[model samples]
Target: MAYAPQEVVDVVRMAACLSLNLGTPDAQRVTSMVSAGQEANLRGIPVVLDPVGYGATPFRKHLCSQVLRNVRITVIKGNVGEISQLADAGGQVRGVDSMPGQIIPLAAAAAYARALGAVVAITGATDVVTDGRRAFAVDNGHVYLSQITGTGCTASTAIACFLGAEHLSPTLSPASAPAPCPAPATAAPSDPCSSLSPDPDTGTDPSAEPVPDQIVLQPHAIPPATPDTPSTAGPNPSPLGATCVTAPIPSAAASSKPAGDHEPPPYLTAVVAALAYYGACAEEGAE
Candidate 1:
């Protein structure tokens, strides 16, 4: 069904997620896809794109680029050939089918994910999902899946469903820990020398001659303790001993933020979950 640009925007605003497929796109559909994607992005709705038959023709490739450029895609699901081609990693693609033996490489997929800044799922015998930083492999589907058409497209739809549900769920609400309290200030111990205030009686004696700088020696002076003769002195013993005030070391948990809190739900997780669910369903149906 054909939709106007305004109509597409209206649909996207009400939708939880948007899915774009290049299965049968023309110049008009391409414009609609861009318009829908932009509207979805503005509404903060997740978008899943399937670049069907991407490398089959230059026109399809161009349309894919335009759609991707216009939208902040959340996830991309495609066959090995299509994904590899999108990543600029050459692969044999005959018509709409990925050439047999044309396996998607993990390195290429990771590079693509990083370049696109989106979770990428390349479907095959062993489905690979990655968000650049982490990759997951889902090996659960029956051989019958390959026999069926639209399995790749179905996977894209499944991803959109999962993204939509995630969007609606309140689990994703912001749950930030409270800011740490400022440590209490403690009084510093007074220096022993500070106790010897200037003699009050001699305070105004400007006529007093400036005394020569000299070290006063006590009559009962004790020799500096030699390092060889270890003194059984506790920390900072006597008024003359050097004093050190060290702050308490914080606990490990308080010092470092929890790894879970820092990382948002991984996009790769959603992709893997969707693929696994589909694969499980396919396996059950086959049996």
Candidate 2:
């Protein structure tokens, strides 16, 4: 059954994040994936893309590149062979499996992250996750993880889940947000020029003689009466909708302090934590 564009857009908007995998990729899947990914981008939803078997065939590589080009992917999870292909470096893949000597280097992974402007995760014996500037090496998981056909696909899902959680959490909590905006009274002193009013006691020429009842009221001089029915003259400055209080965004250096002094960023923490959890579970299953 085909999905309506509005329905797809609504689904993307309501979702916290999106995960796309090309394990069984085809023309229809590629079209749908691009559409969904673009909608997710428009809604500011983080997206995780897993290019399964990317180097297995020329068609796979082309389709993967097309999707990446069209959407602003937040994170990319792939095997060493797939990432190597993406970097346009020498890589060998035989039916979706990396060749024995085609391991991806940590430096190259970091470069890919910088080039794509997205988190790059290259999984192997030593998984490397990078955001261009910082590279994290996670030495986790069990050999049995490789034995499983969809572990990489599942990892992408886990990463997307963590991203979604981080997106939902407030970047600046009450304790870290800049002090509440000062009361309107103290925002700024009334402008001296605007506050200046006509003085009835003193004439324009201070030395001039004062004359009683000299001030003649003009037709526009009277204060208009408040209409019983509120005036709808034009646009209202403060509309009836929700009132938003905008605060200056706290700088990263200032907001870095956590419950503990050295906690990592929420998304980084999530990635590390998810990898650890997956490793623990895989080791347990292996045992």
Candidate 3:
């Protein structure tokens, strides 16, 4: 059955993230994937691409090229061979399996990330995640994970979930964040002789009442509004139905620019975290 582009677009409109898989691609599926990816991009939703078996066939390679050219992918996740193909390092892949002794180096993975302007994840015994600058290695998965089917695809889903949570969730920018409440003023010491007559009958001075050692005025803390919280921070800055895509994949030269001393980007961090979590889950499952 042919896939409907409009239907795919509609689904992506309501989705926090869009994941495109080439495991079973057909002409109609490819069209749908491209349409959905573009729609996701327009809405600023994260897009995760799993180029499964990218180097196994010419058709698959062509499809991968088309998607990369058109869609603004947030993450490109695949096995070492698949990632190597994208990086132009020319690794070997038989069917869907990554051939041994053809691992893509960390530097090559980072270079591919730079060229694509997205986070690249190469899964293996030690998964590598990079955003062209900072690189991270996740060594938490079990060897048995390689024997399971769809594990790589599952990793892509996890990364998409992490990216969606990071990007789609409403956050208070520095400008919109509420300022801290000021400290309350301390009461001045009461004057002893200010009152003309102490207390006509009782000789005790009314103004000289004892003051507590420390007057603590509690400031009511205003918790930041979350997505579920009522009266959110004046509509989310990156609302789900936003009109246009804020960040598209840049050119290789543009993306290759130095990142200075700033920390890794949110999308890169999300990818790394996802891989770590997925690997940990695999280890538990093996046990």
Candidate 2 lands at a TM-score of 0.64
Q: Model 3, 211: alpha-carbon shift in Å?
A: 50
Ranking by TM-score: 3, 1, 2
Candidate 2 structure quality by residue, lDDT tens digits, 4-99: 444666677778888888888787678878899999888888888899988899899888988999998888888777888887756776766666
Q: Candidate 2's C-alpha lDDT?
A: 0.58
**What range of 10 consecutive residues in model 2 has the weakest lDDT sum?**
214-223
1-287, model 3: which lDDT tens digit per residue? 22577599888878888889998887778988889889888998889999999989999999888888889888899988888887877788888878875544444556567667788778887666667665544555678878877889888998888787667445647577444212112223232111111221243422233322221111111221133423322232111111111223344455435444223334765676577567656655677
Which residue pairs in candidate 1 have backbone atoms (N, alpha carbon, C) closer than 3 angstroms, thus clashing? none
Clash pairs of candidate 3?
Answer: none
Candidate 2: clashing pairs of residues? none
Per model, how many backbone clashes are there? 0, 0, 0
lDDT of 3: 0.63
Better of 1 and 2 by lDDT: 1
Sorted by lDDT (best first), the order is 3, 1, 2
> Is candidate 2 or 3 superior in lDDT?
3
How far is 79's C-alpha from truth in model 3 (Å)? 0.6
